[model samples]
Target: MRTNSFTLLRQMVESGMGIGIVFGRFLQVRRESIAFVELRDLPFASPPVACCRMAGRTPTVSSEAFAAAIKTIFHNYGG
Candidate 1:
């Protein structure tokens, strides 16, 4: 089964629907029903992320600031 909702995916995993492969960030805490495994041997790649706004729409001050902040973070991290 495929789902777009993270909450639903987590619920299914916890309920023994099947094993779920997810990012380590999602498994922040230990759960009794779920065993966590880290596949360190696998190659790690960061997914491309975008900070986008609607085309032809005027940007708000807050939106510009947010984009600047995102740019600053990536620059600082050498992304």
Candidate 2:
């Protein structure tokens, strides 16, 4: 059934068999795939990135240091 398929897919994502297909802006990179296409175009679906929230208080750090750290990590990964 369709519900069963959805449950299995959710499990796959949670178990790291694959990454969840997300849309809007949360994903670091978005791939063009069937799941992406379907989810993005679904009339009943909410904006994927909008579902998340700030988990805790913001870190106390200068913006420049945060930017530098992000840049370093991305550069190291060749991303």
Candidate 3:
């Protein structure tokens, strides 16, 4: 069930095997078989996400360099 493929996820959801939540920004009108429900007024707050880094361990040289570059990119992009 773990995948980064949107097409696979959408196909799975449409096949009635499971449900998937595609963000509004990513949803397209290509599939009439799939239904979308907009969720609102949740009891919890949902905040936007930034890059993620591993916790509680020393990062490898490559990882640290990658994180620094990604952080710089995010900084340049301004959130």
Candidate 4:
């Protein structure tokens, strides 16, 4: 079964229809039925990414400010 909806995927996984793999940040693991396991032994891992603006375009004032705020927050919260 394939779904373009994450809500359906989460629902099915929670209902035991199947296991679902999701990016850690997007996984709403608030349900008691779901347990997350880290893939500690993966050969390599990619850093998380966020895209605020496209290349060659001027960043909007709000977008630029928000991006900087996110950067500061992440930097302060970095492990």
Q: lDDT by residue for model 3 over 3-77, one digit each (tens)?
A: 678778666766656455443334456634655544443333454332222223455787568756755765666
Across 1-78, the per-residue lDDT of candidate 2 in tens digits comes to: 133354464456445343343335434253322132222323343554221211232434563475456447545655
In model 1, what lDDT does residue 60 have? 75
Order the candidates by lDDT, highest first.
3, 1, 4, 2
Better of 2 and 3 by lDDT: 3
How well is each residue in 1-79 modelled by candidate 4, as lDDT tens digits?
Answer: 7666767766676665544544444544563445443333233354433231222445578756865675566566653
Model 1: number of backbone collisions: 0
Better of 1 and 2 by lDDT: 1
Winning model by TM-score: 3
Number of the top-ranking candidate, with lDDT as the measure: 3
The lDDT values for all models are 0.51, 0.39, 0.52, 0.50
Residue 48 in model 4: shift from native, Å? Answer: 7.6
Q: What pairs collide in candidate 4?
A: none
TM-score of 2: 0.24
After superposition on all C-alphas, the RMSD of every candidate to the true structure, in Å, is: 14.7, 13.7, 13.1, 14.1
Clashing pairs in 3: none
* Candidate 4 local distance difference test against the native: 0.50
Candidate 3 colliding pairs, count: 0
Each candidate structure's TM-score, on Cα atoms with residue i matched to residue i, is 0.41, 0.24, 0.45, 0.41
